[model samples]
Target: MELKDVDLNLLLVFHQLLMERRVSVVAEKLGLSQPAVSNALKRLRLLLGDELFQRTSKGMEPTPYANQLAEPIAYALSTIHSSLNDKQSFDPLTSNRKFTLGVTDIGEIYFLPRLMVLLATVAPNVTISSVRNTAVNLRDEMETGHVDLAIGLLPQLKAGFFQRRLFHQQYVCMFRAGHALDKAEMTVDEFCAADHVVVVAAGTGHADMDATIERKGIKRKVKLTVPHYVAVGHIIGSTDMITSVPERFARACVQPFKLRYVPHPVVRTPIDINVFWHAKYHRDPGNQWLRSLIFEHFSDQADAAA
Candidate 1:
C-alpha cells in the first residue's frame, strides 16, 4: 500500500490502541468516537494487509505483525513528539509530563519524598514513575527508553551513557535506640558479634555489604537479609539486629524509628551516587529540563563528578 492511501493520524490512533488495547478507551483518550476508532483500525488492517489486532476476552491482542511493527512505530512517534517539543521552551508549570526514574531503594527513601514536595510547588502537573535500580538490566532499560533517568551508585555504566554525580556517600552503622552498643564504646568485635539485618541487592539477591566488609577481613553475624532498605527500619526497630547503610538513609531513618548511627567500624569506601541517562536522549528538551531540576534538587558537590 502507498503512504497516500493511509492517514498518518491513523498511526497515532493505532499506537494508542496498542497501548490501551480497547477501542472505547482509545477513543476516550484520543477524543474520537468508538466507531471512528474501529474504522481507523480497519484502515490500518487493510493498509498493512494484516489483521493487526485480534479481539479476545482479554481485550484486543496484537497480531505478530503488529508486534513486529510496535517498536519502530513507537520510536517514530516519540521522535516526532520530541521534535515538536524542541521548537518551544520547556515550561514545567504548564506541562503535564510523566517521567520514569530508576532509583535504588535507598535513593527512594531519601529523595522521593522531598522531590515530590518540590514538584508540588514547581511542576504540579508532572508525574513520576519510579523503578528499582538493580545494577543489572539498568543499561539496557535506559538505552531502550524503559528508564529515562536513573539515580544510584552505577559505576559500571561506561559507554553510550551520560552521568552526573549527586553525592559521595559513606557507610554508617545503625541500630535501634537503647541498644547495647549505644551505651558502650562500639568496636569492630562488638559490631560483628551483633545479629545483623542486611539488605540484599535488588538484582543479585546478595548483600554487597558482606563482600565489602569481607574484603577488609571482617564478618558480621547476619541473622536476616532483606531485598529492600524500606524493611530495615521496622526489622531493626523491633529486633536486636544492626544494619550498615548509606549515611543519608541512616540519618533519615533515625527520627522515625528512634535509630542512631555511628561511624562504621571498618573503614568503608565512599560510593558515588550519580544521575544517569542514555546518550540517545541527551538533547531532548523534556529530559534536559528534568535532569537539571533533579540535579538542582539533589546535588551540590561537583559538576559531572561521575
Candidate 2:
C-alpha cells in the first residue's frame, strides 16, 4: 500500500492505542468519540491487512505486527512533532503543561523540595503530577507519554530509556539521636545485634537489606518490616529499631525527624540516582527543558566523583 492510501492522522490514534491498550483511553487522550477511534483502527486494520490489536481481559493486547511497528512509527511521529514545533520556542514562563513524574516515596522526599522551590519562580504556571515508580506498568506509562519522567535507582528503565546521573548515594545506618548505636562507630557485630527495621523499598532494586549481612553469616533481629521509606524517620525516631537508608535521604531526615546516622557496616558500592526519560521524547522541547532544569538543580555527579 502506498502512503497516499493511508490516513496519517490514523497513526495518532494507532499510537495512542499502542500506549494505552484501551479504546476508551485512546479516545479520551485524542479528544475523539470512542467510535471515531474505533473507526480509525478499523481503517488501519483494512490497510495493513492485519488485526493490529485485539480486545482481551487484559485490555487491548497488541498483535505481533503491532509490536513490530511501535518503534519506527513513534520515531517518525516524534520527528514530525519536533519539526512542527521547531519555530515555537518553549517558554516556561507562559507554558502551562503538566508533567507527570514517576518517583518512589523516598524520591519524593529527596527530590521534590528543591525541585518545587526552583519551579515556583521559574515556571509558576507549570504543574507537576507524581505517580509511584513502583506502580503497575510504569515503563509503559512513561513510554506512552502518560508519565513524562522518572528519577531514582530504577534498574528496569534500561532499554529504550535515556538517563543522566544525578548523584551516587551510599547506604547509611539511621536511628534516633539517643539510640544505642548512636556512637562514634559501629562494628558489624553491634550492627547485627541491634534490632532492625527491614525497609522493602520496592522499585529501587536495593530492597535486599540483608544481603551483605547474610554474606558474613550474620543474622539480623528484624523488629519490623515496612514497604516504604516515607515513615522510616518517624518509626525509627519513636522506636529502638534502626534502619539502613540512602545517605542523602538520611541527611534530609536528620533535623526533621531528630535522627542520627553513622556509616553502615555492610559496605557496598554506592547506588546511582539518575533522572530517566523515554528515548521517544528525548528531543521534545518541553521534556528537554524540564530534564535540564532537574540536572541543573539536582545533579551532583562531578562533586560526588570528586
Candidate 3:
C-alpha cells in the first residue's frame, strides 16, 4: 500500500464516480469508456483494499470506507486541481488585484471585519471593497464583471449564477442588555407589545416574514423607523426598543452594542447565506481563491456540503 502503487488519475476517476455514482455517467463526464471507469474503480478497490462503491437501485453508493475517505479525498483533489489549473496562477501574497463584492449593509458588518484581518496577514497586497447589494444595478454590474462576487440572502441572483451555501441563519429578537424582553421566553403578546424600531431594508424580500406574522395575528409596536440595519443596533441599544434580525447580526452586535437576544417567539424560516459568482469568472484564480477563503471561513455547513 503505497502512493507509487496507485495511479493518481484513478483518484480523479474515484472522485467523479463518487459524484455521479454510475460508471457510465462517470465515464461520460471524464471522457472515457464505461470499461475504463469500471477498471479504475476496480484498481481503486485493490489499492484501497475496500469494495469502495456498491451498485443498487439508487445507483452506485459508496461503502462505509468510501464515505470515510470522501471528505479528505475531495479536499485533496480540489486543492490539487486548483493548484494545477489556476488561471494566471494567483498568488495571494503577491497579487495586488482589488475585488469588489456586492453585499447588503448587514453583510458588510458581518463579512468584512474578519476578512480584512485575514487579508492583512495572508494577502496584504489584496484589497476588498463592498457595495450595497440593494443597488439597482447590482445584477448588471456582476454580469459585466465590475462586481467579482456577492454574499448574502440574495434571491435575485439565484437564476443565472453559481452559488454555494455557507450557512442558514434564523431570526432573533434583539434588545438592550438590560431590557425586560431579555427573559428566557416571552409570549407573542409580550413580543408584540414591546416598542420596536422597524427597519425597511429594500431588496431584502422579507415581506413574507411580515405576511407570516400577520397570518398569525401577531404585530409589534412601532416606535421608530429606519431605512437600513446599520443603525438598528445603536438605536435599540440606547433605547427601550426591540427588533427582529438575523441571528449572526444579533450575535455580532450583542457584545459590542451591549445588546442581548432571545429566540424569536414566532417560528420563522432560516435564511441561507450563500456566496455567489457569475459564470464569467468561475475559473478566474483570484475569484476562486477569494470564494474559497469565504466559504472556508464563514460556512457553517462546511463539513456537510463543502
Candidate 4:
C-alpha cells in the first residue's frame, strides 16, 4: 500500500501478467526469464498482501483483487509512459510514430484511403495500422493502450471515454450497374423477392439490416453472405444478388466495382459513426494531434447534425 514498499518495476510485470495471465507468456512478452517473472509476482503479492493470481486449468486466472487493480494500474503506467516520452509539442511532419486503429470493415473501406492521402502530404513519416474493431473488447483495449483509436459505431462507450461524431450513415441497396433493377423504382415486393448478398461485419454472423427486416416481419431471400463490405461490391457487382451497405461506402465502391446504389426499402434510423478514445489519452499531445487529423479529414459534422 505504501509507495516506498512497492518496487515500481513490479507494476510493469503485473500489467503484463494481467494481459498474458500465464507467467511464461508474460515473461516472454516482457523479455524476462520465467523465474524473474515469478520472483516479481511473488514480490508483488507480498507488497499488496494478496494472492494476485491463481493457477487453474485455464492458465493463471486473476483473483478478484487483481481484476480490480488491472485498469487503474494500466492507466497509471500508460500515463507515466506518455508523459515521459511526449515532447513539448507533437511534430507530425517529422515524427516517426506508428498508430494502431480499431476500425470496422466499412470504415476502413471509406476512411483509410482519404486519411492516408492526407497523412502522406502532412506527416510523411507517420504510419498507421488498422485492426478489426468490435464493441465487446473496445473498452478494455482502449484502457490498456492496445488500440490508439477506435473509429466506427460504438454505442458501448458509455463512460470513461470521449467520442466525436464522424458521420451519419443510412443503408442502401447496391447491385451490378446493369442489373434488372438498375433504373426501375424498387418496390417492397421486388426488394424482398430478389436474391440478396448480405455483409456480416467483422465476421460476426449478424447484420443490423437483417435485424431491422426481421422486426418488420420481412424475410429477405439471402443468397450469400460475406464477412467484409469490400467483398460485397465484388460479389454483388458480378451477380444478380444485391447487398445493402452504408450509403457513403456504397458510393465509394460504385465506380471501381461497377455497381449502382438504390435507396434501401427498409425504413430505419440512420447509424451514427463516431471516433472513440480513452479519457486517459484524451490530452496526450500525440493522441490529440492524430485525433484532430482524423476529425478534420473524415468527420462530416454538417451531415451528422442533419
TM-score of each: 0.67, 0.70, 0.69, 0.68
Full ranking by TM-score: 2, 3, 4, 1
lDDT of 1 by residue, 1-306 (tens): 676876889899889978999999999999999999999999888888999999999899999999998999999999989998867466789889898899888878998998899899999999999988774488899898888998887766779999998777778888999998875447989988999987877453125656878888888798988877888998888877998888889878999999888888885777777888999989888899989888887785423453
Per-residue lDDT of model 3, residues 115-200, tens digit only: 99999998999999888888757778988889999998778886678999898888888999888888887678888889988777
Highest TM-score against the true fold, candidate? 2
Instruction: State, as a TM-score between 0 and 1, how close model 2 is to the true structure.
Output: 0.70
**Clashing residue pairs, candidate 1?**
none
lDDT of each: 0.84, 0.87, 0.87, 0.84
Model 2 spans with C-alpha error above 4 angstroms: 1-88, 301-306
Question: What lDDT, from 0 to 1, does candidate 2 have?
Answer: 0.87
Candidate 1 TM-score to native: 0.67
Worst 10 residues of 2 by lDDT: 297-306
Candidate 4 vs. true structure, TM-score: 0.68
Q: After superposition, how far is residue 48 of candidate 4 from its true place, in Å?
A: 32
* Candidate with the larger lDDT of 1 and 4: 1
- Predicted model with the maximum lDDT: 2
Per-residue error (Å), model 2, residue 273: 0.8
Better of 1 and 4 by TM-score: 4
Model 1: CA > 4 A from native: 1-88, 183-185, 202-208, 302-306
